[model samples]
Target: MASMVWTRYAAIGDSFTEGIGDLHPDGTPRGWADRAAEALSTRAEGFGYANLAVRGKLLDQILDVQLPAALALKPDLVSVSGGGNDLLRPGTDVDVLAARMDEGVARLRAAGADVVLFTGVDPAGSAVIRRTRGRVALFNELLRATAVRHGAHIVDQWSMDVLRDWRCWSIDRLHMSPEGHRRVALAMLESLGVQDAGDWREPELAPLPALSRGARLLFDARWARGYLAPWIGRRLRGRSSGDLVTAKRPGLSPVGK
Candidate 1:
């Protein structure tokens, strides 16, 4: 099995893997998994790809729901990334989350698929998610150790300074923008020893205009009304954004070619 050429690639996780912010013209999510699949297909003429990821899923939900399907696919490579949703909730224990995630990684490896794991990204657009930076760091440490123990490749998102830029995030302040997803796909391929399109890291842009205190407050209010409030409502009702959503790419098939 050459590191650069995988015949089949399966992705399992939550919104990030599902491609929330990067949407097609018809509104279908086309995320990093899709990009990686396209890149892999270029390396291998008939590459197959499946993405069993849904938006707003927790680490545990992904383990219970998506992992089984992924194992059944018997892909040569599997990308497993989750835990951010769990960490966002109040009083969530990241260590326990990490432990559960570690078990999932071990299971994937035991199933004989080369696994790729990811660390949570620090949010630059939201003060609320920004506050979780310390907790996210702790989880990333555990994730790194888990990858090492399970012989998995880690994407190391925590080490990427490009993610610190606010431009990388979508307006919802939770998911990455299309450009952000593109960069992540390139990074993932590079981590797997696969040559990608070009440099994932681009030159920095000029800083955004400084907002007055009143204008900043108004912007925060709009964000709360548009995104944060609805998210909280769903949490209170014990629902998820992915409640009935199915996998975007449910079966392995040729991509790019």
Candidate 2:
């Protein structure tokens, strides 16, 4: 993408945009979106940013709730990243979800904002495994088409080999590690044609030692018990991690203040 100018930027979505995996010293999220805003602030005279993302929200919920708030700010930008949460549910349809996302993008464009969209990453090595990967692929493709139709810039995570490295993911394996989030920030800055954007292409590290089948099973069991079970229980109870949780950054203001 060519160099762009956006002084008032707003982010909207779920945990990924909410900076769940990357944390500040005070235990608050400082994800890629925040990093990107920091870089952009250097270029604009009076840049301001807002992040309206909450954890565990569906795409429709993000669009319906967060979109209005973001538009109300009259942002020069609306970074869209969501839909992974909806795909996790058993019966969600990719086409329908894409259509819903398209509507949101259209609205953002209509509001005269530069729309930046993010694709979902590969879901390998998760409990859902192969099936989830295919669903994610389909959804990513649809998101690409949606971006094209709405003239939005896209950050394609599914095809990013940099993310395939295990070190890029957090302990939960669902969110990006701190280093990973930094890499994503660099990529975003470069995507927006920000000059002197630092390198995101880190060399892959040496692989970890292989685990025995028994040890692997033990890890899997622990993961299921610690993460998977609680997530399932929340869904069963119709509860969400974001229930009553609000965006860490709710309005456009100077980056540091």
Scored by TM-score, the top model is 2
RMSD of each: 1.9, 1.6
Ten-residue stretch with the least lDDT total in model 1: 195-204
TM-score of each: 0.94, 0.95
Candidate 1 residue-wise lDDT, 1-257, digit = tens: 45656898999999999999998777889989898888788778678999999999998889999999999998889999998988887688988999999999888899889999998876644667877877888999999999899889989887777876768778887889998898899889888887536667765556778989999899889988999999999999999999989998889988742
Alpha-carbon lDDT, every model: 0.87, 0.86
Global CA lDDT computed for model 2:
0.86
Provide the lDDT at 184 for model 1.
94
Q: By summed lDDT, which 10 consecutive residues of candidate 2 come out lowest?
A: 122-131
Clashing pairs in 1: none
| Tens digit per residue, CA lDDT, model 2, 26-133 | 889999999999989988899999999999999989988999999999999889999988888869988999999999999999989989888887777565544678
